[model samples]
Structures are given as structure tokens and as C-alpha cells.
Target: MSWSMSLTSFPSRIQTHPTIHLLRPIKPTISSPPKFPNLPTIRSVQGNFDHSPITPAKTRWETMLETAASLYPLYVTAGAVVACLKPSTFAWFVKRGPASYSLSLGFIMLAMGLTLELRDLLNLFVQRPFSILFGCAAQYTIMPAFGAIISKSLGLSPALSVGLILLGCCPGGTASNVVTLIARGDVPLSIVMTVCTTLGAVFLTPLLTKILAGTYVPVDAVKLSISTLQVVVAPILLGSYLQRTFPAAVKFVLPSAPLFAVLASSLLACSVFSENVVRFKSSIIGASLASDLSPVLCAKAILSGELGVIILSVFLLHFAGFFVGYLSAAIGGFREPQRRAISIEVGMQNSSLGVVLATSHFTSPMVAVPPAMSAVIMNIMGSSLGFFWRFINPSDSKDSPKVDDK
Candidate 1:
């Protein structure tokens, strides 16, 4: 139960109960890396002036935006609940055209790409190839496998099963980067892992979804691959190129990019939920009737039937992913921050992508439900984990420049 025991041990310890207390006690002192002679001091450089001081207005604005960004879980939770209650609120986001899913996802991918630098990817592979490869491998393998097992164990319908499995096979979410930053984990590694898994999804997502979900329904791997390339790969590369070619424009857009992506993802998930509200209401009623022994138990029964199973199954899948991912990285001899990065990367699936793929490729709207629900659940879980680690590991401050560098 000591920090020195290596992070791989978390799975075993947390299996009985995954909670904040599972972390070891540590002094709240910051840990510093070894110092070298005559190293240059890092400073933020703005184009206008050599000695321009930060103004109160500018600081307040930055603080306000950061506060908003950190409340992502709140926004997502509210959005999901509203979408379920009144479909019209989010339905318009998708009704504009057939390409709504693709456009939303493309914009999200473009925002992610703008944050990345080519050297960041290269440096990650060159410096810590094992961690990157291990994370990507776990991303494709562990979650997909867990998804199928959890789906079958829960005895979900074929459509729901496929949706859950598709979610499992998807890439690490862009939000994982922000969560990693909050958790004081290896941000560079998180970003690199996200990029690697996302690019790898072009091949792995379609193929794995076909292999794992084909039994549930017909899966056209070729179509999925093409769609992924169009929605994901192309936009990301375009944005990355844009960042390099037009640094000025990128600088202007970079501050708002993460928030935009977060909002887009929330809107996309809400839109899907809105589209399926009728079916959802009917299912809730049916499930409640099936379990209720008397009229008095009607409300309670709905909480224990189909909806309950879906929520439980999704929770187990992600909890297992976060635990197993940490174990895997610990086994690979990585320490605290890298293990945290891998855990978050593996656990947080790109739910927005899952929603798009399920709805676009599958005939049933029900197939999109799990992913839509996941958009809410994963953020809550990720943010909780981040804040927990942030408290215990005070030494891993967010202000450290090394956290941003590979």
C-alpha cells in the first residue's frame, strides 16, 4: 500500500472497491526532476511586447474559461438529462442534414489535431515507444474484449450488444487529454496515446467491430473503415497541417478548441438520445411493468430492469478498463503518471464516434443508446478520478512545464 509498490498493483487492491482511499498516503510536497547547469528558463512569449505584464482582465478571462472547461462533466450530465426529458432541445443539432454526425465528429477531430504538433508524436515514439504501444494495444484489445463479455453477461439485446462493443473498440477520447492534465498525469504521453489510438482506429475499429459485433448484426468493415477515414483521419491531418502552416490562425483558435470539441461531443450525444426518446420511453415503461409486483412499485421497477442493466454493464466495462490498463502499464515497468495516463486513455472511449457509427451503419436506433449514455458516465468517472489523484499527488502540479513536454 505504498507509492513505491508500483501502480500495477491498483487493480488487485481496487477490485474489492475502487475508491479514493485506495491511493497510498504521501507527503504533499512537490517532486522535482534533476537539475542541469545553465538550462534556459521557460517563459510565455507574446508577440506584442518584450515586457508586457499579465493584466487582471486577461487573467480573469483565462480563469473563467478554465473553470468552464473543468466543469465538463456537469455540462454533459445536464445535457443528457435534458435530451432525455425533451428531445427537441438537441434534435435540431442533427436534423440540419444527413452528414450531421460526420460534421460534428470532423470538427471535434480537427480541434484535437490543432492541439498536436508533429514532433510531439515523434518524440513520444522515440522516447517512450513501449508506453505508447502498450497503451494503444490495450485500447484495441482490453476494452473490446470486456465489452463483449459484459454485454453477454448482462444478456443485452443484439443491437445493444453491438453498440456497447462498438464503443469498446473505439479510440481513446479527446477528453482524456484534459482529464490527464487535471489529474497531474503525463499530459504529453496522454496526447500521444490519444493520437496513436485514434489513427490506429482507422484499421482497428472497423476490423475489431466486425470481429466482435458481427454476430449481433451485419458489419460492413469496409464501410466502417471508409467512414472512419473520412470523419476522423482526414480532418485530423488537415488540422495538424493547418497548425504547422498557419501558426497565427491556430494560435487564435487553440484556446477555444478544447471547449468547442467538448460542446460538440455533448451535442452529438444529446442529438442521438433525442432521436431515440420514443423508443426509450416505451422501453422504460415495458421494463417497469415487467418487474413491478404492484402499482406502488412502478417507479422503482424501472430503476431495476433494462435501464439498470445498461448502466451497470457500461460501468463495469469502463472500471475494468481503467483498472486493467493500469495493471498492464505497471507490468510494463512504468510508474505513476504514465500508468494514470494509460488508465484514462484506455477507459474513456470516444463515445461520440460510437454514437455516429451505430446510428449511421446499424438499422436500429436502439444500437446508439449505450454510446450516448457513455458520454455522460465516462466524463463523470474520469473527472472524479482526476480530482482524486490531484489531491493525493500534490507533487504532480499542473504548472510544471515538463508535464507538457515529451
Candidate 2:
């Protein structure tokens, strides 16, 4: 957010002094640590003045792109509807199977990595190891446990239960970083928490899912671990490596990365929904017909059945995660912003990872549904919570940089 004057280009027809070409390349400076420093890392280095000044036209285009990328929840919801009504619309993506799922999800991880600096991740951990570790531990323990309880209490089907549990066992989502910014929370902590939990998920996700979901169905922990390594860890590390190794190229592509992630996540979720459309339809139809009622009442009856159960179970899982995550953070004596960051991080799972994992390792399509629904539901919830926090805490409305001081 800082700027420095530098020499600029002239018309080729004009001769320039030798000193004119010696202008130094500007390094972008972040405003402050927790005020979403990395956010602009993915955006253009507008401060780099060795080139032509930014045009209003280009700024408008970039704004349009950013707006499209930020409406992630709407995109996911619309994709789900389209998939349900016209399954064939997403058949191409589904027909490709694991290859498709892995690629889509992997790209998202890569994009996230590009937005990071490995050194920053390390600095954050060194600065606040306890806060980050506590959040990560809660992420693994609280959600998975609550997921199991909710599924059982709701009396969901075996496959649906595994889906909910798997969703919980996964890591904090990238969307949480963005939500934290909106909530005026500790953006730096949110980013670090997401990265740590995602990387840790290579081990924890498989182990936890195997333990909690094992009751509903057999789980091969080894296979789950391998799948996670391939689909999650590898892509993220590769992206980080590329960012460090090729800074110029990374900068060039950074603006497009977020849009790509948004599209890929939306497409992947909808494809899964389309792939499992038959099961969804059958479940709904059967549930609707359970009362043996007239066709006019079938629509309402559907919500009272298996589909309803899955929806309710998934909703309860996230709701409890948000509430419990906050309560735990407050009890730990963390400040307000840190609590918001932890709450959002814990409440929103990497549902895309869950969808990919379920499809790759589990035979049941129903096992993928809860995560698919989560893709639609969690964003709405996260955004609403962010708005609520931002408005209620007037003193914290602007992202305060004091997050790192603690």
C-alpha cells in the first residue's frame, strides 16, 4: 500500500539519458501484518512503477474479476441447482472420475500456496505457536467429534454419516481467510491456520476420518492417507516451491489464480452432485412417497426424509463447530480478533477435499453428498457470521494490526 516514484518509459522515438534506465524495481510493501497483507500479493503489484501507470479500464476489469470470484457461495449454489435439474450438464466432469476431481481440487491448493510465502508461515508459527497450535488442535478434535454426535443424534444413514464426519475431519478452508478479513479478524493468523491445518490434514484427516467414520463403514486409513497426499499436500507444496522459484511468473499469473480456484471448486462440486444425481433423486422421491400422500404434498414430504436428514445433519455440524470453536477460544483467553479467526477457520471445512476423498476412497455416492451440500451451506453461514461480527463489534470494524502483538 506504499508507493515510490520511479522512472518510466518514453516513446521509442525519443532518446533517453543513461541514468533514466537505472530506476530500481519497486518491492511491494504491505500496510501492516494482519490487515490482509497477502491479499495484495495475489493482486497486481500496483506499486511497481517501472511500467506504465495502471489504466482505469484495467482497474475496472480487475474489479469485475474480483467480484465474480468473491461470489463463491452463489456460484456453488447455482451449480448445485443446475446439476440437480440437468445432470448431464456436469457429466463430462464426472465421467472423468478421480483424475478430474484431483486436478480440480489440486489446482485450488496450488492457488492458495501461490498466495503465501513459506517464510511468512514460519514467522507466524514462531510468533504465536500456542495460538496457532491450539486452533489447529481444536479444528481436528472438536468438529470431528461434533460431526459424529450430530450424525448419530440425527439418525442419518451410514453413508451420510460418513460424509458429515469426513467433512469435519478435513482442514480449514481458504474461504475462511477471506471471511476473516470481512469479520475484521486476524487475517494473518487466519491464513497461517488454513495453511497449517491443510498441510497437517495429510495425516490428521485420514486418521480422524478412519476413527470416527469407521463405525458407519469400513475405512482404509492407508488409502485415505495416500489419496490425501496426492490430492492435497503435493499440489500445495509444489505451488509454494514454484512461487519461490519463479517469482516473476507467479506475479504475472496471480490475478488469474483466484478466479481459477473459484471456477474449479464450483465445477468440481457440481460435477460430484451431477454424478450422484440418481441417488439424490431416488432418496428424495422415496422419502416424499413415504407418507403415501397425494402428489401435491410430495414436495414437502421430501424434506422430511433422508435428504432432509442429510441437510439438517450437515447444518448442525457446522453450527456446532462455529459455536464451540468460539467458546473454546474465549475460554483460552484469546483476544476478540483471534477468536473470530479461530471460529471461522474451525467452522468451515475443506469440503472440496472431503468430496474428492469420498469419491476416491468410498464406494457410496451418498458419502459425497454432505460435503457437496456443505460447499453450498458453509459459505452462506461464514459470510453471515462475518457480517454479524463486523457490525456488532464497532471498535473492531476495521482490521486492527494488533493481532500479531498478542
Poorly placed runs, candidate 1 (over 4 Å): 1-59, 283-300, 394-406
Residue lDDT tens for model 1, 1-406: 0000011101111113223343688555544545555754333221111112333343565556656766778888888788778878866676873388889999989887887776656754675676678789989999999999999988999989999999999999988887877777766667788888889888999999999999989999999999899999999899889988999998676767777777888888878877877766787778656866466576566656677777787898899888999888767666577778889999999998898888789998878889988988898998899888877673343443221213
Assess each prediction's global lDDT (C-alpha) against the native.
Answer: 0.77, 0.80
lDDT of 2 by residue, 81-103 (tens): 99889999987888898789989
Task: List residue ranges in candidate 2 displaced over 4 A.
Answer: 1-58, 282-299, 394-406
247 Cα displacement, candidate 1 (Å): 1.2
Clashes of each: 0, 0
- Which residue pairs collide in model 1, if any? none
Positional deviation of 190 in candidate 2, in angstroms?
Answer: 0.6
Q: What is the lDDT of residue 310 in candidate 1?
A: 76
- Which candidate leads the pack in TM-score? 2
